[model samples]
Target: MRLSKLFKNAPTVNITGLCLDSRKVKKGDMYFCLPGMTFDGHDFIPQAIEKGAIAIVHSKDIIDKLPGVIYIQVEDVTACMNQCARLFYSKPSDKMTMYGITGTNGKSSCANIIKYIRDLKEPCGYIGTIAIEYGKVRIAPDLTTPDTLFLQRKLSDMVRAGMKSCALEVSSHGLSQHRVDGIRFDVAIFTNLTYDHLDFHGTIENYFEAKSILFKELVKEDGVSILNIDDDRYEDLKECSKARVVSYGIDQNCDYRAINIHENAKSTSFDLVYKGQKYPVKTSLVARYNVYNLLACIAALHETGMSLPVILQSCTKIPQIDGRMEQIECGQPFHVVVDFAHTPDGMEQMLRYGRQVAADKGRVITVFGSAGKRDIAKRKVFGELADKYADLIILTEDDPRDENPKDIANQIKEGIQNKPNLFVEDRYEAIRQAIDNASKGDVVLILGKGDEPFMYHESGRVPWTGDNICALECLKASGYGENNNS
Candidate 1:
């Protein structure tokens, strides 16, 4: 690609690549000096040039002239880099049908469901919290929604690999920072709005407003906007969107409605009502929230030219999403579920369903904690919800980045009233204690950090196994391995 095509009134230069970090700059690469939350790329301009960056795109004015490097000043480096990335990638999102799912929860499950159904008919790509996968190429994710440059590059790769569709999990921080600015989505889904990320967003309304940006701008005019009518902000989202609206829920009048729902410990069955007809839908995924997720997937696929029968048939084949409500078994009499429920609403749903799964059999034991340096107000709320649902609670550490784990756990302990709770700072000890105390017919829920590979602390991320793996190890140590019938 030529530099003139990406920049305005610029000399012709062959642009080899685009880079944001100065350390990653290579020979003939164009480096972008953008300002971030903590570090300023402008301070590293000399390092970028030293690392063989041929062209420098910066926001600050430079009076000193380098020997052979080209310096292009811009009003905003972030916006300029975004445009340059789109040009370099040839706007690959335009060639494929893009589906974006955004909300406080269920984004990963819905995105994976869409990918699963689409992959049954044609090649598809997925970008979310779990992983980025397309055509046997799978990579760990750095963010729920990546930076604009990497996002465009990955979409271009998907296009080159002959993927017909793609599903993305759009986070509020990603939207507010314009990480997905250049891509136009064919379908936008709203799961629900709840209390989360208040430390960054300041309030719930600001968070919702940030999320509304996807429907208002990124979605094409003729695209479809699928929303959950059961959410309180459904009407607001409908009014904010310029695209055609397609609502899905169990309550209000929606384009897709799930009725006669039947949920068990293993599976859930519901009749999907569309227009004036009802279609039987059965899925291996449990819980009520997943019914909403399945409906959202069905609506998005239906709008994208998939038949109702095919969508229903695909629902039956949709496997369990990792770390959402994943069950781990080891020939034990009790049940163990590992989930990524961190927010207040998510905790409530997980506990409610956990209680249902353990009905008349045993007690519900919840093991969870709040993340450090996040919305501190939600800590007490999480404690309150755990007290309301679980028979026993164990508060453990969940990424106490810079704050003390004891302080974070104390805040959660303040909300519990006359409930049996234990404070354990070590996460491994907490999991072991929960499992060891559990009797036959008891359900143990290990929450917060689900499939994550590491534990964050002041010293930086340390190598750690996932919750499922740790629980299985504990069960094995207790003589509950596959061969043991006790």
Candidate 2:
């Protein structure tokens, strides 16, 4: 593409490539100088040019101008880069129906569910925490929300692969960084804003305001915003949105609401009440929290012009959302679940479900730990929630990245000190202990680090089997499974 396609009134130059990181700048590539939280991209301009970046796009003023290189200064570097990427990629998101889902939790499950429903009608692409999937392409995500250039490239790939729609999980960090700005989303879904990522936003209000950017700034004025009216931030997000608002929840006068919910060991059934008509839904999804995810998915599909009956029909065959209440069966007498419930709101709901699933004479055993350099406030709260609903609590390692693992566990132990709990530093051993201690009919809940393949540590990217896999291995080693050799 011509450089002029990116910057108006600039010289027409053939751009070979685009780059955000100067280290990755190739010869003849156009490099974008971004002002970031930690490092200033402007400082790397000479290095980018040194590495043969012929064109420089920057938001700040250039102190020293180099001859023979194109310098286009914009008001916002990230926004300008986003626009350029959109143009360079031929605006792939516009070619397809784009749905963006945001929240502290459930973004992955919601996005995945929407993709599954859309796939029943037509091929749909998905980009989120677990993985990026479209037309047999599966990539382990480096970030929950990839960079603008990478995101546009994937959407372009999806469009080329004959996908008519895409379900994308929009993260608060992505919103604040202007990563998803140029895409014209057809529907924006807000699951719920809870107390997560406060370390990044500093305050709950700031975190909320960051989440609000998607509805208020990104979604088209003619597009629709789907919100959970049962959430505390519903009023704020609804009021902030310029688009038409559609609400969904279990307890609210919503455009889509679930009623008469029923759950068995195998599945959950709920009636989706919209307007005056009701659609029955039954899926393997368990827990009240997932009911909210379903409502949001149904509402998004409706706004996307999918027939309500077809969507409800699709809901009945909902695929198990991996790591979000994913069950691990190995012929154990008790039940075991692996989940990505790392926040207070998420853990509370998962534990409540755990309490319900435990047999009358069984126990609800939970094993989880907080991460390093995150919202420390939630650590003790996690302990308290486990104390309330779990019969035994086992604290273990979870990305204690530069911080001491024992210290992280102690912070969580502060609240449940008087309760039945064990501090186990090694994550694998903790899982083994939890499984080994489980009696007949007991329920084991493993929280945090869901299906993540790597554990974040100070050493960086340590290989680790995922929570679900580890739990499965431990269950097999416990000598109860029919397939076990032990």
Q: How many backbone clashes does candidate 1 have?
A: 0
Instruction: State the TM-score for model 1.
Output: 0.98
In candidate 2, what are the lDDT values of residues 213-316, reduced to their tens digit? Answer: 98887556569999999999999988999899999998877889899999866689988888888878888788998899988998989887999889888877
Worst 10 residues of 1 by lDDT: 215-224
lDDT string, candidate 1, 1-486, tens digits? 888898878879888999999989988899999898899999998998898888999988888869788889999888888888988999888888899999999999999999999998889999999999999999999899999989999999999999999999999999999989888899999999999999999988899999999999855666999999999999999999989999999987789999999999889999988988989999988899999999999999999988889889988878877788988889888889999999988889999998998959699998998999999999999889888889999999999999999899899988888679998999988999999999888889999998888889999988778888889899998889767968
Clashes of each: 0, 0
Q: TM-score: which candidate is best?
A: 1
For candidate 2, give the lDDT of residue 87.
92
Q: Global CA lDDT of candidate 1, please?
A: 0.91
* TM-scores of the candidates in the order shown: 0.98, 0.97
Root-mean-square deviation per candidate? 1.2, 1.6
Displacement of residue 94 (Cα, Å) in model 1 is 1.0
Residue 235 miss distance in model 2 (angstroms): 1.6
